[model samples]
Target: MIDWARLQGVYGPAHDVPTLLQAAGNGAKEAWDELWIQLWHQGNTCDAGIAALPALASLAQHTNRAVRFPAIELAGEIVGAGLREGRPLEKMKELHQPVAMLSALADGWLSERPAGYRVCFRAKLALDGFPVLSDVLDDFLDFCCDVSCPQCSDKVSIVIGDFGCYSSIRDWNLGDVHPIPLRPAAPDDLQDAAQGLHHAAIRDEQPRLAWGLRHVFGDAECGTCDTAFSVLSALEAKRSPSTEFQENAGAATAPAGHDEGKNRHWPAPPF
Candidate 1:
């Protein structure tokens, strides 16, 4: 006895909102895509999802929080992904557009009126990444950092310059007896640090060194560092203990002619 038409009217032009809401719960790819398309094409709506954001975010605050969590997360994912995809900024002229939407979503996540601190932190990072969007960044960060959202101060921290250096700074401040040098790593050292950072980030660990490099050296080096880390991690995994054991077993069982090393003085294996 669900009134489908009434439900669609209540949600918006796209009766798909409820479907998307449900899909988010189940991790339905289609539902996610639909939601992304709506937010991405926010230009199609007069209010740009502003009116509906609050209600949608409220669902995340329910007693059964899981039911609403996905919906709330999807909201941020859509916007963040859209921006990352390099959507044309001309389509979103209002300086406060994405910021406002994101602020509301963050508010719902925090279970209170949206504090602008986290939003401003994200906005600053986003702006730092996309300088062309400077005006929007300025307005959004300003609004979010306003006095009303003082709670943001507790939630956000700023680290300036090169990801690797920043990581080093944080480590140093943490009372590490011997902190990694604060300057950019030497070319080879940078390569090694980059590799380390990549593995750390992939493993969902903090890539302090990598972050410092990115924050200091800029995107190109940061990307190189990530690539190096990925390649190194893969190589290391390929040579893991089990893999080494299998290779050694194969060598030990080789035919007589392959006994070249068997007659020589063999060094003891490290392990």
Candidate 2:
């Protein structure tokens, strides 16, 4: 049993955490917002966040996906933060079952075809213990990521959306006029987390995401130096990329978009 008064949250003593959780479970968005601020602030988590795992799982179990989402997502964030902060292995071990349960809940939510696929993907990554990769999923959702050119050190954005998949300098007025089209990797060539993400996008019928995955895992060149680089590598250099997440994530099943006894192809981009 967790002693709320003894556990510290971002604000101070966590006595109000239970009340917040109850309100969140009762469909109060304000409570969930407050919980996010108190339990997870700018990627930092607290003892109260860790202590709330079991209760968060219960809250998810009893609510609709909208209400349930914040519960499971918060649990993921807490677990991910714990992993990233190098918390004691035994303490993490104690959380194993709850994390696994939240993971299952995330998968169930995904199967239900929620409004946001990226959020589901993020939750899955966090629950899978890949904190860095989970956070990077936000980049995919935004359809662009700012990265520095490996050769010239010029800042550029990799746009992967209806506008098209390419790299270009940040131009507010002109807007991507000097675009360097990205060369997307074929499904057969994809590996690691990229492969798994592509597979999930295909399976879930999110063609825009699938199309974006190709470019995300594909090749690019600097608009400044005209030097070539991998899009994935540039993104990784922006933060501490999780190598373990890469090596293990590739065990994903082969592309399932193939029609029986017929040819299959990458989904057409939404653009």
lDDT of 2 at 203: 80
List ranges where model 1 is wrong by over 4 Å.
1-14, 19-55, 58-63, 88-101, 104-271
- Considering every candidate listed, which one attains the maximal TM-score? 2
What's the distance in Å from true for residue 135, model 2? 5.7
Best by lDDT: 2
Candidates in order: C-alpha RMSD to true structure = 19.0, 9.7
Candidate lDDT scores, in order, read: 0.33, 0.71
Candidate 2 runs further than 4 Å off: 1-4, 16-34, 41-44, 58-67, 77-91, 116-118, 128-142, 170-178, 189-194, 225-227, 239-271
Tens digits of per-residue lDDT, candidate 1, 217-240, equal 321111112111221222222323
Which consecutive 10 residues in model 1 have the weakest lDDT in total?
140-149
TM-score of each: 0.28, 0.65
Model 2: lDDT of residue 39: 90
Candidate 2: tens digits of C-alpha lDDT, residues 1-271: 7789899998788899999998998899999999998898767788898888888888878757658888878888877776667665335666768777887788777777778767777777677655665765533333666678988899877766544467777566555546777898999998765566667778877776677668877889888889889887787666543443344232222122323223423233554
